[model samples]
Target: MPKIALAQIDTVLGDKQKNLSHIKDYCRKAASNQANIICFPELVTTGYSLDILGTELWTFSELRGGETDQLLSSLSTKFDLTIICGFIERGGSLGEIYNSSGVWVPGGKSWKGTFRKIHLVDSERNWFSSGTNIPVFDTPMCKIGIMICHDAGFPEIARILTLSGADILFLPAAWCIHYKDVWNINCASRALENGIHLVAVNRCGKEEKINFFGDSQLISPRGKPLTSTLGDDEGLVFGYVDFNLQAKTRLELPYLRGRRKDLYNIDHSLIV
Candidate 1:
């Protein structure tokens, strides 16, 4: 069994200082609750309004070993917990920024594996460079797969990770109020279909013109909403998941076993 915490926080766009401070406070709260791994919403340090920032957004994007990454790594060490957080990443070359999610393992000196957003939504294409890698990472408690805001809508991402043996999935999102229904459906459907526990953390409050619906949630392998904070309030949502249960679900339902890969084929060579 593992306890997980989802921090549904309100963020000020481009305010790294304010946002990082808020994250520390929630990390303390989550640590106090004895959570093994805690996750924050997408773009927790900088908020999700980068498209509005134009070239100024590049100023906020941090290189892999930058200050924000160091701070989060220290937080993970201080709390002795694994944290999956979203941040804007600067590639090796100039002007190459990505919408990326990363992990801070408790004993590691730096942020571990990172998963950049592959599916950019609407104006997001104008802002961040899309990622191609779908990486799964190892934590002390479980094998985790990472997803950013728009990635959750695509079933292939989850299926690919599930096929790679990710026991739990983390979705860090800034899902807007208008698409609240889609958010719920997507989260539930992903968990039920994949048979993996999901912790989908969303931001609260408004960032400029976008009003984010703070519905941070934790779902079981069977798609049960164990704990959720569904409103415009910023807070912590906690839930417990057992690997034994996940194993049981796979054994009983066994959808992956029955999957007809031969009949359902999407040729990647023909499509982008």
Candidate 2:
């Protein structure tokens, strides 16, 4: 069993210093409690975006390997914990931006994986480019996967990660109040479908007029809500990831073993 901490943090728009301070507090608390991994919400550095903030935010953003990357790299090494969090990434000369999540491991350089938010909700599409690739990685704790906020709404991304041997899913989201309910559903559904642990950390508080529902959650392979928190409060929620239980459940059910992929591939659109 692996103990993980999900930090339901309230971020201030364009306030990197404040966000970093808050992250330190969460990290300290997680360390005290012996959490193997500490996850944070989407765009944790710049906060959830607003139209005005998006226009004004580009100047503050950094390309990969810049100051922002260095800071996260240092934190990952210092804490000796794998840190998974979201950020605003600047693509090269193409002048594109992405809603990206990064995975940082201690001692070694952080392996950066990205999700560009395939389903760009509301005003987001105006600012960021859509992500194309869905990837899952092998972590020390387990085979892990990363998906950004809106990607959770798409079943294919989760299914792809699961198919690629992802045992645990990491989601960094900035879900608004109106769509918060759907976010919960997505997390549980992904866990159930994949028969793996799912960890989601969502941003809370006001980023302009949009109030976020901060119900960061951790769901088990059994599709049970192991731990969750809601509303605009900032806190750390901890839960255990039991691989043995997941193994047993998958062994008994064997849903993946029964998939008719050959037939499905012939025409994925065909109703079963």
* Model 2 C-alpha lDDT versus the unseen true structure: 0.78
**Which candidate comes out best when scored by lDDT?**
1
- What overall lDDT goes with each candidate model? 0.88, 0.78
Model 1: per-residue Cα lDDT over 137-221, one tens digit each: 9998889999898899999999999999888999999899999999999999899888889999998898778899887888878
TM-score of each: 0.96, 0.92
Expressed as tens digits, the lDDT of each residue in 1-272 for candidate 2 is: 77899999888788888887788778778878888788998888887665768666676556767666777677767777777877787877877787777776776554455555566777777887787777776556777888888888887888888889888888888888888778878988888877878898888888778888888888888778888575578888999988898888788767677788887666556757
The C-alpha RMSD of each candidate to the native structure, in angstroms, is 1.5, 2.4
Model 2 residue 125 lDDT score? 78
Highest TM-score scorer: 1
- The TM-score, computed over Cα atoms with residue i paired to residue i, of candidate 2 is 0.92
